[model samples]
Target chain A: MYGKGLRALTLATLVALTATFALVVFWAPNDADQGFIQKIFYVHVPVAIVTLVAYVVGGIFAFKQLRTDDRKWDVRSYVVIHIALIFNVVGLLTGAIWAKASWGHWWVWDEPTLVSFLIVFLLYATYQPLRFSIEDPERQARYASVFAVIAGAFVPLNFMAVRMASSLVHPRTFATAEGGLPGEMMFVFLVSLVAMSLLFWLLVKYEITQKNVTWQIRALRRRLLGDDAVAPIGRSAAPTIAPEAAKPLGQRPRVSYENSPEARSRGPEEIAT
Target chain B: MRSREPRPMRPTWVLLRKDLLLERRAPESVPAMVLFSITTFVLFHFGLGRDEVEGSLAAGVLLVTILFAAILGINRLFVSEQAEGGFDAVLLAPIDRTALFLSKAMALFLFLTLVELVAVPAFAILLLGPSPWDALGGLVVVLALVNGALALVGALVSALAIRTRSRDLIVPMIGLPLLVPALIAASRSCAPLLAEGGASWPAAKWLAVLALYDLVFGLLAYAVFDFLLED
Candidate 1:
């Protein structure tokens, strides 16, 4: 079931992204002024938008983790944050390149383009240490989840605060010729938005797959080696294997931890399977 | 059989009294705040040079100095609590979570305001010259609003800092940017007041913005305090 869903998502993303790129390059009208360089906007703006969406999705998953106490949501939140960081980095690079071409400077400190990206980068960068610092899984998830919500709230507020600063550093809003945009450019922009969202979804799915596989391998190892070798997983543990699978080749699986020296020292309660 | 019940308001008062009594005995926070404000004023007076008119700049300088000092004090407020392991006790108290937040914020606000009352007059006499009583009123309003906003936001950041490796660094990282609007509003409002002039539209607008900020973040801090205080 999961394999089929993955395949369908992959096919849809490939087709959508190809169409979007083609439309951006050929069909959309060039700036009556910026010429070829304006093409960067199609990529830069959509990616920035999707990056914000990814962070918000991460925040939502974080909230879910707190409410449901589910390890799955914690993993999902981590994957979304990872994808958001990647997209944010790409957005920053594309923005800097675009700024150099148009503004005649390699970096503009006051530009909303530069400042907002910096804030988002700093916010996500703090999440990793926050996750690792706590020893317990449930505690780590809870604290990180709260931090995510607070950081998510600050994102829009920071953008607004910077916008209100009394300086003519960056333009308030994007300008397209003819007041808004020509119809073709609008179509291209929408297509690009959809394409980027799909790409992010696929990336998140891949990362989550890798994470769950690693988790399952660890659990399997613990099962085979007996409870003595592996410390008990906390409240965030993956579900136990079904009873039919517990027999392990009809040899009466040696799950006992009583005889192991390490388990004996720690006490029986710590080793019970 | 009688059922045991929680004391509703007493825990909050106990926490508030504990902070106040500590201030009365040691008096470290208020004195340090005053000394810091004075030193900051002197530095700015010398740094900006006498050619710079002290009137408008004086208000901004005072506001910035007071906030910087208050941040120092607020950062230290939790230190003693943590050292004595009193924070967990407070968390384990029977009071509503919001009351704990409010009590801490209120105590800090009162202490900072007392320091400001002394510093503002000394600032006006030495640097900006004497002003009309109306300026004092405006200054009071500005300081109250600004200090409340700071305390509200600072409480949450302080809570976050406790869990982090670098508690000191994280407080400012989360705070300075958030404080910008309040800083601007306080400075603008006080500038006109120092001249004994009526509040201008721009000053009023800035004050309105400050009020809006306080309302939004005050509610936010209340809502999130539980999450932050969670074990």
Candidate 2:
């Protein structure tokens, strides 16, 4: 079920991303101020936006996990955050490239957007370690959700606080004091944003499907080959989908292997319960 | 037989009283925080190679010292609970889960305030170039708000880390990043008061930022805290 819409999402992401690149390269006009350097903005800002929104979305999923006590939601939340963290790294790197080209520095602390992203990144970077350190799977999921909720509320507030602390010396691309973005630039930016959002959605879908598939395979192995044939999952930072949630493959009628012909040769009481 | 249930806040008060009594008897977290703050001031004096600091430097040193000390206290806030199985006892009681959060936050707030009573004055004697009395009222207001933020974040982080392995490593790593905005607001607000020429009142905006941070996190920690208490 997780993979049902994944193909269409992947196609949409492919088309949108290709269109975004084509438009940015050939269609969008150069910025009057920064010229070619501002081109990086298309990739940087959109990725940043997606990363922040994805984090909040993860929080929403975490909230659902708590409300419903569903292991699947935890799996969804974890994947979303894990992918968003990758997107966050992309945003930071792109921002740095843009900064180096524009300001001649690899980083600029004066920019509240960049600085806020860094703080948010640092906070979330601990999520996995926090998850890994707890031994109980249920507690790990519960605690991770608690963390997600808190951190989700924090993202916007942290942005606001960082923005306030900075005296607005850094130039804002979207709403410059000069005025809002020009018409064509706005269009291009909007397109890029949509493309990035689609890509983020595609990645999340792919990751969730992968996790589900792996889990389903494991469940299938357990059901067909017997419990001894399957390995214990052991300690992990990733949230697990309960075998019950894995469905038909995992639900094949339990075979009493002990009653089978091979086991009959060995006798009933000889088998370990 | 019918039994009457206590008021919702009764458990909070009971837990608060217990924490206060424990601190009163042992005198552990507060004194340790106070000692750490003073020691950090000495280290800052030598590290910065400045006999006296003023303005932003003064604010930075003072707040950073207090923050690190607060982290030290946060690491221990839930230690007794973990060790003595206070969590199970609380879970068995017919009280709201948030009562434990409220009590723990309040206890941390009180401890932080007590540490400041000595630490802030010590900063004045040891490293502050300006007369703190000039901005005493404003400084108190700003520090109180900062303490509110720290206490809220500290209690939450402590609870989160309490059951984890290597909790000592976890508290600061998680707590510090979460606390940056509060520190930003606090240091900015206190910079004016700590200026060398003369102390002055903090800006309205910084105080507003601090208040907003407190409100948001306070509500957030409140809402999600019950989930953490679940077995």
Candidate 3:
């Protein structure tokens, strides 16, 4: 089911990304003030927006995972966070490149937006370590959800605090690319946002489908070569698929939570290592 | 195993009392916190090589000292619980499980207050430029709210790191970053009070931020705690 819309989403993303790249190089007007140096805005701003939105979306998925105690939602949440971290790195790199180009510094504390994003990046960087430290899948899922929820709420608060402090001290507005965007620029920016968001979704979908396929392959090996043939996974941060779900291609009962009662809940699949 | 869950605060009080009694009998966390504060004060003196610290510098020293000492308490907070199987006992108890969060937070708050009692005086004698008398009254009120927020955050971090193998390392890594907004608020509020001219009242906005943090995380932790304890 996760892979069902893959072809369409991938095609759309490819079209959008290509179009965005071409438009940035050709059609989008140059900034009157910052000039050619401002072109980085096309890549940086959209990636930043998508990353923040993806983190919040990850939190929402985590909330649903908690409410339903479903591993699928956790997987979705994990995938979102994983992808967002990658985008976050892109945002930081592009930001640094922009900063060095404009301000002559690789980093600047004067820009609250950039500083706040750094803090957010530092905070979310811990998500993986926290997940890896806990070996139990169920507790890991639950605790990780709690962290995701808390960190999600913390994001807006951190931005507000940093913004307030910076504005009070510097009294200088480091206008983001969106501020006072002209009609032509706004059109280009909106297109870039769409393109970046599509690319994000496509990558997430591809990752999930890839995970699903890996699971199915493992199921096949278990059936064809017997259980003893498959070596086990060691302690890991990745969400464990329910054994029934993982074993289906190998002929195990696929009594999923969708149809099962609450009492039918089972412990997480064996590590088998 | 929760059964006939009638008493909530009663278990909370009992647990608080138990932790207090234990801390009193052997004196594990609070004493070490006091000592750590005094030592860090000495370190700051040599480290910064400043005779009289004021304004943001003073605020930074005090906040860092308190934050680090609080980490000491937080690191040890769940030790008794984790080592003694207190979590198991709590789950077996018929009372509400939320009491655990409340009691742990309360215990942490009290320990923080005790640290502040000593650390404030030490900071005054050792490094403070403005007279302690100038802002003592207002600072306490601001700090009470700040302490409340830290207590909630400390407990959440404690619960988070307790079950992990690298709890000692994880606590500070997770906690210090999580405490950033609180740090921003507390240090910013304290800066004006510790400024060179004279100790003055803290701005109301920082206190509001602290209060909002407490309210938000207080509810967030309570809601998610049961899941953390679930088997």
Candidate 4:
């Protein structure tokens, strides 16, 4: 079920991303002030936007996890956050590169946006460890959901506070002497945004489907060859979806170990002996 | 239904009283935090190689010291509960689960205040270039606001980390970043008060930021705490 739309989504992401690159290179006008250097904005800003939005979406999934006590939602939240953290690294690296090209420095403390993102990056870097340290799977999911919710709320508020504290030493990305992004640049920016968002969604869906598939395979092996056929999951921070929960109840294997051919051949007496 | 149900505040007060009484009897967390704060001051004195620091430097040193000291207190906030089966005991009680969060945050707030009482004066004497008297009033307000931010974050982070294998490592890693906005606002507000010319009132904006931060985190911590308490 999780994989139902994954292929189409991935195809769409690839198409849109390719189109975005085309638009950025050929259509978007160079900034009057920064010239070719500002082109990085098309990639950097969209990734940053998608990263932040992914975090909030992860929080929403976490909220659902808490409300329903469903392990699947926890799995979804974990995947979303895990991917978003990767996007965060991409965003930071791209931002640093852009800063160095434009401002002659790899970093600038005066840019509130950059600084706030760095703080957010540092905060979320602990999420995996937080999940890993709790031995109980249920407790790990619950606590992580709580953390996601809190950190989600913290994002916008932190941005506001940091921005308010630091004045505009760094130029505003969208606004300029021209009174805002030009129509061409804005179009390219919107296209890039859609592409990045699609990519983020595709990754999340792909991960959830992969995890569900994993659990279902294990459940099948357990059903066919008996419980000992499957290895136990070791300590992990990632949430594990119960096999039955990942699929419709009707689709589950009808023959369990007790009712299998192996069990019939062995018989109760042979096992007892 | 049970014939008797305790009032909500009753549980909060009971827990608060228990923590306070425990601190009074043993006096562990507060003393350690105070000592840590004063020692940080001494280290800053030598590290900066300046007999005195004022303005933003003074604010940064003072707030950073108090912030780290508060982290020390945060690490210990849940030790007793975790070690002595207090969490299970509370789970068995009929009272609201948020009471645990409330009492613990209040306990930490008090501990931070106690540390500041000695540490702030000690800061003025040791490294602060400006006279302490002029800045005392404004400094108090700034510290009080800073303390609230620390307390709320401390309580939440402590609960989050307490059951983890590496509780100590997890606290500062998570807590410090969550706290940076508050630190920025507080230090900025305190800078003018610590300026060499004389102490003056902190800007209204930084105070507002601190207040907003406290309010946001306070509600966030309260709402999210019950999940942490699930058995």
Candidate 5:
């Protein structure tokens, strides 16, 4: 399952993302006003949008974990949050760099761009500590669900508060009545957004598969070492044959046989005879 | 061990009375809030170069200082509750949790408002002479809205503090950013009234935003208070 899906999705996302960037940088016209630096918008805006999308997905998984009490959803939510954090940091850094090039300053505290990034940073930073502080799995998931919902609610509120506080230091979508984006730019932007979303989904699937495989291996090892004769397939079965060479020093020797449980069920005297 | 009897409001009132009585005995929280307000007002006066025209700035400065000091007092109130194990007793009560939140919020609001009442007049006299009493109506509305918002946030933070490390530091870290919008709204609303004879519409709009924030968070905190207090 992981082999097929991971390869296909990763290849598809890479192709799409490369094409979108190529279109944005080479094919799209330079902004009438902001010139070459405005190209950063193609990356920054899409990343920002995807960051929000990732967070909402995380919150939905969190809610599902609460309702179903499923550990899968918890893993999904956890992985998605890490992905979201990556996108958030990238978006913030690129925005800062763009702001410096365009506005001649690295930071603008009053601007919505800076304020929204700060809020997202603070909200996601709380997730790790909140998770670590709790000892019980179910209780940790429950509290985290509540915190995720609260954080999700606050994100929009913080956005609105910053937007309402004052005029933007840089142009904002709301500043223009229709948020005038030329058709070509809008198309490329939409493609970039879709590509990022696909990439996020693929990464989440990869992490979940990795976790599932790791658990499977651990369970197999446990069964191989245990005395129980009930050999569960796919999980580790007790080594049917005890290898004389592999036995550790100072350990008891046991009868060695493979394929037939009958030979293993016999006494050591019968096997020696 | 159980007996059937009528349980009255006595427990909640007892809690409220205990809090008030403690305040009455110490007299420190309220006085400190008031003194903080005065000191801030004095600093503003000196910074504004003692110009009577600067009364508007004084109103904004005085109100913010009083609010910050009130937060200090609220943090102390919850810290004392944790220290004495009084919070557990309150949580064990049979009364509705909303009542507990409401009663505590009201008490803190009253205490903070009392400090504000003193601060307002002292601010007015020290900065600007007595003016039209009609503006007092607007002031009352702004104060009620801001104080309610503050108390609601304070209660939520207090609950968080009990469960987190560095209880003192975490409460303010979480609470202060949430308070910024309300502060901006209240200060803007009060500035025009204290400076000129009329209120600005923009200021009134900000006051409305403050009222909305108070209503939304107030309901949220009340609903979640029980979960927060659970063992």
Candidate 6:
């Protein structure tokens, strides 16, 4: 089911991204103020917007995970954050490139939006280490959910604060607020937004598909060669599924701590009850 | 069990009292935090090569110093819970888990206050070019709000990182960036107050930002703290 609509989504994203690139280079008019340097906005702004929105959506998924105690949501949330982190890197790189082109410098803290993005990227960069550090699968999922929820809430507040601080010193150039983009530019921007969003959805879907397959393959290997043939997955930052989820009904799923820290600290009696 | 439970504030008080008593008995976090701040101020003196700093320089130095100092306390915030049986005891108790969070934040606030009591005047003596006393009232308000932010954020980050192996590394990496908005609001609010032209009241809007940050993160830490304690 994870890969069900992946093909269609991938196709749609490909078309949209190609169309976007074509329009940006050949169709859209140059900005009166920024000239050709504004071309980067077509990709940079959309990627940034999609990255931020995807991160929030990841939080929402984390919330769902916490509410329902569903590891599926955790997997989904992890992928969303993973892919969004990549897009965020793209957003920052392209933004820097655009800044270098528009202004003389590579980084301009005066650009509050870019500054906020940097802060946000730095924050989310810790998510992996946070996840990787905790070895217990259940505890890892739960703690990661909590972090996603809190950091998700941080995005908008951070933007507002940094923006307020910067606006005092410089005029708002990136303020795509009212009367910002003209007609054709807005159209192109909308197209690019759609493209980036589709790309994000496609990436998340593909990641989930990969995860499900890996779990299923692990299950298959254990089934064919017996549990001893398969090694316990050592410490990993990636989310792992219940062994049973990877197998069909009526098959018994083995539960072993193997060399886990949880096994060492917890007495067998403590673990049983 | 819920009916027999002590009221929320009661446990909060007990926990706070326990932390204060522990600090008084052992003196682990606060003394280190104060020493850390004063040491950082000296480092800043040599690092920046300025005998005296004013305006933005003063604001930057003060905020950065207090921030790193707060990191020390945050790094050690949950050691007792993790090392001892405190986490299990609290989970076993009928009292809400949020009491732990509320009390820890309160304890952190008190420790920060203690640190500032000595560190702020020490900052005034060593590095501050402008007279800190000139803006004493405004500085107090800004520092209080900043303390609120640090307390909430520190408690939350401590919980998040407590179970991790790389805790010492995780504390500052997670806590400082998470503190940017509050940092922005605090630094901006303090820059004018610390100006040599004489201390002036900061823009209320910046204060509002700090308050909002504390309120939002306070509620957020409350909501999410339970998951960290789940067995």
lDDT for residue A150 in candidate 4, whole number 0-100: 84
- The residue pairs that clash in candidate 4, if any, are none
Score each candidate by Cα lDDT.
Answer: 0.71, 0.89, 0.84, 0.87, 0.68, 0.87
lDDT score at residue A143, model 1, on the 0-100 scale: 70
Better of 5 and 6 by lDDT: 6
Candidate 6 residue-wise lDDT, A193-220, digit = tens: 9999998888887877777777767777
- Model 4 misses residue A111 by how many Å? 1.6
Ten residues in sequence with the least summed lDDT for candidate 2 chain B: B1-10
TM-score of each: 0.78, 0.93, 0.92, 0.93, 0.75, 0.92
User: What is candidate 2's lDDT per residue for B1-231, written digit by digit as tens?
Assistant: 767865788899999999999999999999999999999999999999999999999999999999999999999999899999999999998888899999999999999999999999999999999898998999989999999999999999999999988789888988999999999999999999999899878899999999999998899899989988898
Considering the two chains of model 3, state its CAPRI-style docking category.
Answer: medium
Q: Better model by TM-score, 3 or 5?
A: 3
lDDT per residue as tens, model 4, B1-231? 776754668888899999999999999999999899999999998999999999999999999999999999999999999999999999999888999999999999999999999999999888989898988889889999999999999999999999989999999999999999999999999999999999889889899999999999999998889999998
Error of 5 at B220 (Å): 2.1
TM-score of the B chain in each candidate versus the native B chain:
0.88, 0.97, 0.95, 0.97, 0.84, 0.96
Worst window of 10 by summed lDDT in candidate 5 chain B: B195-204
Model 3 stretches astray by more than 4 angstroms: A168-179, A242-246, A249-273, B1-7
User: Residue B144: error of model 6 in Å?
Assistant: 0.7
DockQ of candidate 4 is 0.82
- What digit string (tens of lDDT, one per residue) describes model 5 on residues B23-88? 898786788888888887788778877646434564567667767777777677566577888667
After best superposition, candidate 4 residue A120: deviation in angstroms? 0.5
Please identify model 5 stretches exceeding 4 Å from their true place. Answer: A1-4, A53-82, A123-144, A168-179, A202-273, B1-18, B25-29, B39-60, B125-135, B196-202
User: Against the hidden true structure, what lDDT does model 3 obtain?
Assistant: 0.84
True A-B contacts kept by model 6: 0.95
Error of 2 at B71 (Å): 0.6
iRMS of candidate 2, one decimal? 0.8
TM-score of chain A of each: 0.78, 0.89, 0.87, 0.88, 0.78, 0.87
Worst 10 residues of 3 chain A by lDDT: A264-273
